[model samples]
Target: MNILFVADPLEQFKIYKDTTFSMMREAQRRGHEISACEPRDLGWQTGQPVTGQVRDIRLTGNADVWFTETPRRLAPLHGFDAVVMRKDPPFDAEYIYATHLLGQAEREGAAVVNRPASLREHPEKLAVMEFQQFTAPTLVTRDPAAVRAFHAEHRDIILKPLDGMGGMGIFRVREDGLNLGSITETLNKDGAETIMVQRFVPEIAAGDKRILIIAGEPVPFVLARIPQGSEVRGNLAAGGKGVAQPLSPRNREIAEAVGSALAPRGLLLIGLDVIGDYVTEINVTSPTCFQEITEQTGFDVPAMFVDALEAEVARGN
Candidate 1:
């Protein structure tokens, strides 16, 4: 089997922590020929799909790491059995363009995971708003007046970029917050990128939950990401600590609902964020937590993910 991973440069990866690295390692272990090319490498030449270069990849050491050898030119989307869109994102125009190219590939009979159309259509935060009944009090707006009103009503609010990943640009404002003006000014500049403002769930002081879903089924383990001292962010990138925990009944319910809703759309793999009982985010763009979950639970989630991909490949055949 041949697999193509559409991702960033190899040198940019932190082998121990990157989920893409793990996925590549697992695929290699299973004897699949793995290759990589950046999204920008995709293009159309004389009405046929083409790419700049593709490199064969392999794991190098005791760690589930990755190293790519020399690159070779290949037909754009025809040779690989599966293409994993594992690029990290701010979901900008380039990301949308890459999805368009991958969607074209899928139409031409290649299996593109997380279906490209769904990836373009579903902005993680906005897509889950359909399940508002299960989420916290949330608002999406760039208007300072509207944000201030929401803060006044909720007394405590969390603000984050509507299109952010890995918990970047997230901020929390208390009941008597003093920096709302400056914060909103900085975020809402540059032609009106709205922010997500939600009523802060005090239960987050305990920890936020990360649930991994594959092929519409919950993976059976959850990580409670506890924030460091005086911090409000629960992202491991933000100094949070990850502890293995079993899913509560409520957590299982939310995961099931979200997984079932998203699976058929080509979002075959997802990491859902739950703070307390409220669903805060649905991470589709290179979602993490696989390493933490596997390390603590010994579940071999990377293998599970490979199984899902292989199934997709079989279906395509």
Candidate 2:
């Protein structure tokens, strides 16, 4: 099988931690072909088949410089047996445009992981509203007044932009609310943008657990990203320490509830962000933690992902 990964620059991958690279390695182990390109490389001029100017590469067992370039060319996404939309997201306008291109590829019968439409329909920060019972009290609003009110109500809350990733632009407003107005203004852009405000989950001290669901089935272990000193964000990018552990019953419950509903909608993979027992985020755009979980739990996460990818491709055929 041939797999084309729509992702960040191949040269920039931290192979030790990047989930996309891990997936590529696993696929290569199974004798599948792999190539990569950033979303910017995708193009769909009038006469093209929703094409991407990608670099074909094969993975090597190197701790550094893990991939060797084979060739570079413009090809229709449908030429590949599976198209993995593994681009990490701010979910900005460009990302949305890329999805439309990928959606076009899907229409042309290429199997795209995490269906393009589902990526558009379910923004990570906002998708939790679909499973309110499993999520913390969250408010999505642009109004500074509403934000202030929520801050007052919850006493301790987290405010972040709708388009943020890897804990960027996140703030915690405590009861005293030292910087509430300024933070609200910055995040909302004077009532011009929407943001999410959720009551701060105290259990974050333990860890913010990332539970991965593949093909509507939960991975048995989760990578619990524990925040470093004086940080509230448990994102590994934010310098959190990842600890892999078997998923608790509540974690399984959330994954099962959310996965069962999303799988039929073409979401081949999902990452559920659980704070305590509540789901705070549903990361569909390139959900990660493959290396961490595998290194600690002895679970072959990337191999499992490749297995699911192969199944989806065959099913589509």
Candidate 3:
């Protein structure tokens, strides 16, 4: 199998814990060929299939320089056995454009995990709304009055930008509402942009759990990212400590329900952010924590992912 990863630059990867690297390693170990290209490398001419300037790469055992690759060459995306989309998000204009290209590649018979159309349909922050039964009292709006009203009712609430990733632009306003107005203005861009606001879930102290669902099945273990010090965000990138644990019953329930619905829509992999019993986010674009869960629990997350990828490609064939 030839697997082409649509991801960020190889130089930007921290091989020790990067999930995309883990996938590449597992695929290579299984004797699958590996290639990589950033979304920017993808191109399509009027008469040509969607293509990329892909670099064929091999993993080196050394940690300092983890991979060796040949020079880039143009290749049609449909030529790969599987094209994995693992680009991190701001989900900006360029990301949307890349998805459009991937969608075209899919039409040309390329096997793309987490289907491009589904990625466009499910914005990480907004996706949770589709499964409101498993979430807290949440609101999405840009009007300051609506935000203030939500704060008045919920007292303790979380405010975050729609496009934030890794805990960026997240704020908590308690009963006193210390910085509610200011935070709202900043997050919503003074009514120019919309944001998500939810009643604060106290169970965050236990951890913000990340449950990985592959091919509509939940991984047995989840990585609980616990906040450090006074931080409210439990994202590992926000200085949180990651601890792997078996999924609680509620966690499994949520994962099963969300997974079943999403998998048929072509999301081969998903990451659900669960705070207590409630899901806080539905991550489709580059859902991670594979290395953390695998290292602590020995569950082999990347292997499960590769198995799913193989199955999908076989079915497509």
Query: Which candidate has the top score in lDDT?
Result: 3
Per-residue alpha-carbon lDDT of model 3 for 1-317, expressed as tens digits?
A: 99999999999999889999999999999999999999999999999999999999999989988899899999999999999999999989999999999999999999998899999999999999899999999999989999989989999999999887999999999999997899988888889999999999999998999999999999999999999999999999999999999988889999999999999999999999999899999999999999999999989999999999999999999
* Over 4 Å off, model 1: 50-52, 62-68
- Candidate 2 lDDT tens digits, 244-301: 9998888898899999999889998999999899999999999999999999989999
Clashing residue pairs, backbone N/CA/C < 3 A, model 1: none
For every model shown, what is its TM-score relative to the native structure?
0.96, 0.98, 0.99
- For model 2, name the residue pairs that clash: none
Better of 1 and 2 by lDDT: 2
Clash totals for all candidate models: 0, 0, 0
Error of 1 at 201 (Å): 0.7
Supply candidate 2's per-residue lDDT for 271: 96
Q: Is candidate 1 or candidate 3 better by lDDT?
A: 3
lDDT of 1 by residue, 53-76 (tens): 687766666554446476567666
Worst 10 residues of 2 by lDDT: 62-71
Model 1 RMSD, rounded to 1 decimal:
1.6
